[model samples]
Target: MNDIENRLKAIDFFCSGGGMSYGMLKAGIDILAGIDIDMSCKDTYEANVKNAQFIHADVFDLREDELERKMNLTKNDNNLVLIGCSPCQFWSIINTDKTKSQKSKSLLIEFSRFVKYFMPGYVVVENVPGVLRCKEESGLSSFISWLTATGYKVHFEVHNVVDYGVPQNRKRFTLIANRVTDINIIPIKQKGEVKKVKDVIGEHNGFPRIEAGHKDKSDFLHTVPRLSDINKKRLKKVSKDGGNRLEFANDPELQLNCFIGKDEAFKDTFGRLWWDKPSPTITTKFFSISNGRFTHPEEDRALSLREGATLQSFPKDYKFIGTNIAAIARMIGNAVPPEYATAIGKAIIKSQKNAI
Candidate 1:
């Protein structure tokens, strides 16, 4: 094989905080650059990821020719890998406004333009399961049809991120298309290797016990959001570990007005995580107890930024750059779990070795 074909290189689209970039690098894939429009991601992406440049550009406006010129990519490069893990708020099942994601929903179509122009050796996509459920609406069906018709072997499926070694139970749609050989992208871990929350966090895992609103001056990322007086009182009454809001159903004082009549609904809200189980999906609002079962197993506060990042399989020393807690949480929650990405990268490397 020629040097160009022997060397596997990648470019990550919508790479937030360089999760996929860093993970793929761990598997020995050379990352050319990470492209994202969010300027907030630039510092974090550059700070933690070495050898890969961060390109600040909106995919919708970025022309294929410009990308090829900027990256010096050639058409039909068999060693090239193009990954498009676009913003999933539109395809997400979260109760968000439809209007806000109207423009983002068509990102797959935009990404397809690059795939068609470059016809890279491999193409990767990871997003919410809703993208597969609403394939036509999310432009996935069309993209798949095109890939198959163009002689590319394609495989797409919805996978629980926990199955790929992410400590959180996030379900995502993953697709890998290859023009050189049969497509095989999904990574498989050995049975009984699933990780639990206790394995990654808490005092046993080096996270010191801290009260609500405690901020470590040396490591500000370990800071937890402050709890209100009412929330604090309610949390004090709830059980320490794996407690749910249902305990307050009979108590008129602590019961939220929204859940009074609907006692059985939204049980995860204001709930504590189970120590022995994988964590619930970490959302963009994980710092707030009202969001999900985000409360620390023992601590009174919700998961700190560092804790959440750890749960997402980010390395201990990986740094995120953002002042606003909400914005930083969004970056962590939106990321493709680094461990899962590493698995995918390993699978790709295995495929390359097998082909030889």
Candidate 2:
């Protein structure tokens, strides 16, 4: 049994697929409400997390009164915490074409509006490392300044997910600010052997071999890609556990466009994951075998949605709502790994105690 007062209450913004909320809940924090623009996330958020209210509203159009009412919260609730992790597609290094979009940059300003209006006791923001390079004139910088001006002690760091026990090499920028605490908070990387890809997948965990377009009934998000005949033959020539295209490309017909180039650096393309190493970062196109180093070590097809979710630290029992692969992949890929979130939650709880 645990004491209720020690549990913090939080509202998550841009809460896609409920990863942060799931972590907070696991750490004993009560998530009061989750707000996101995506309707597909509602069922997943509400179904998996108990007592969390889901609101499908654009942050730009969200009203103070409505949010307060829906959350059963008041402006005077100093114990409340606000978590904002807006979309990072605009600022990601992978999106080199800057002209493609810059709309999500405005979301930080919108998040700041809530902080200014509610004056919550604590605030947390997580996003890509590119966010740190965004100009001070940008909305993100202004939001940071506003939090500082409000007497909050702030801590921010760019960290790899693997440093915090997630079995993937994803990096993120994390910021935690608190109005009530004077303590300096830093996320402590657990001292242990780093987890590997083989430690996470395969039949040992009850995950069976799945081909493309086939959904696992037990794990609905699990969907594997069907392999083409040419790719199958290529994979066959490659070694059993750790083979790549370089091993099978002796046949002229098996060469891909990128493989023919002398200076190409994408060696991981069409590669198999080593069972003992951390998995690569899960991306939106994770369902496609050709997207990145997503091929299964022993299987011929790309990793299923459930495997991606597992790498993202989502529990096997967690249910995603969408029927289409794109929607499901977006939800899983966009999520903050629950393990990382739990670490953040524990830190916040520690800071709150020291504040007294």
Candidate 3:
């Protein structure tokens, strides 16, 4: 096929704010549409992803025939790519109320329905490692088995995003299935030093310092959650440049009632990030210093919305649409790192080229 004819068209399911779609576009993929239940993602997805329509609908309610009709998709199209990055909180290893996410556990199964009906040339799935650990419960095992049974070659493994040029040390389970041939998701080997927090964030990286509850004058989204007076005092006592709560352990006023005896447990909570190292996993509560080691290395407050998005490999110009800081943080934290998605897209293209 000629270059124009060989172009791959992709439709991203659960495409929250167009992270994966943006990266695929960066790698020369033609994104046709993004489907998600959250109406908040529509504006952001439509604005940043050129030539792609945003469909606000629950996956459970979306029928294969409806999707085929809406996107004009044909059965067994060799150049069609279906991307699924369903919400993985149910299978995430994080400590949370599982009951809230119980409904999301079956989303992968829902995604498999489209895969079976269309049998697209390429299929991609990205989720947390817990999905593999509890594959049966998450429907991942059956999905892989069905794909392999039907002549699709499948490859899946858990990989850290830092190895794929993302500045954060986020681990994700990735699966790539193709009917034309066996495919692989290769990590981008760094020539020298990998990216560190200092290299991509802080004053050196153009993110000027803004105090807690203050927004950067130039960017309104560069604002952090307000810390209470006690939390502010606690943060002041906590040393700068990657210090922990242990520094204020002896201080009676700074210590919390819940953490009196459990010094070793939950050490990451209310901790500062190391300047020279890659950041810990960014979560939905990354805007709060009480959540993980989200505090800025030298600053007194937690990361801003813009900083959180930056850690997730989003471009500076990418605008987020949300009602509040927490809502925006959830969108940023749950997104696939765009750089890693770009790498995946490139690998698929390389596989296609080799097959030809």
Instruction: Mark the regions of model 2 whose C-alpha exceeds 4 Å error after superposition.
Output: 1-6, 97-100, 240-242
Instruction: Find the candidate with the highest lDDT and give its number.
Output: 3
State the C-alpha lDDT per candidate. Answer: 0.87, 0.81, 0.88
What's the candidate order when arranged by decreasing lDDT? 3, 1, 2
Candidate 1 residue-wise lDDT, 102-123, digit = tens: 8889998999999999999889
TM-score of each: 0.97, 0.93, 0.97
Candidate 3 backbone collisions, by pair: none
After the best TM-score superposition of candidate 1, give how far the Cα of residue 243 lies from its true spot, in angstroms. Answer: 0.6
The better candidate by lDDT, 2 or 3, is 3
Q: Which ten residues in a row have the lowest lDDT in candidate 2?
A: 257-266
Clashing pairs in 2: 197-277, 198-275, 212-224, 212-225, 212-226
Q: What is the number of backbone collisions in each predicted candidate, taken in the order shown?
A: 0, 5, 0
Tens-place lDDT per residue, model 3, 145-248, is 99999988888999899887788999999998999776654534445676788888888887888889985544337878788998888888778778888777
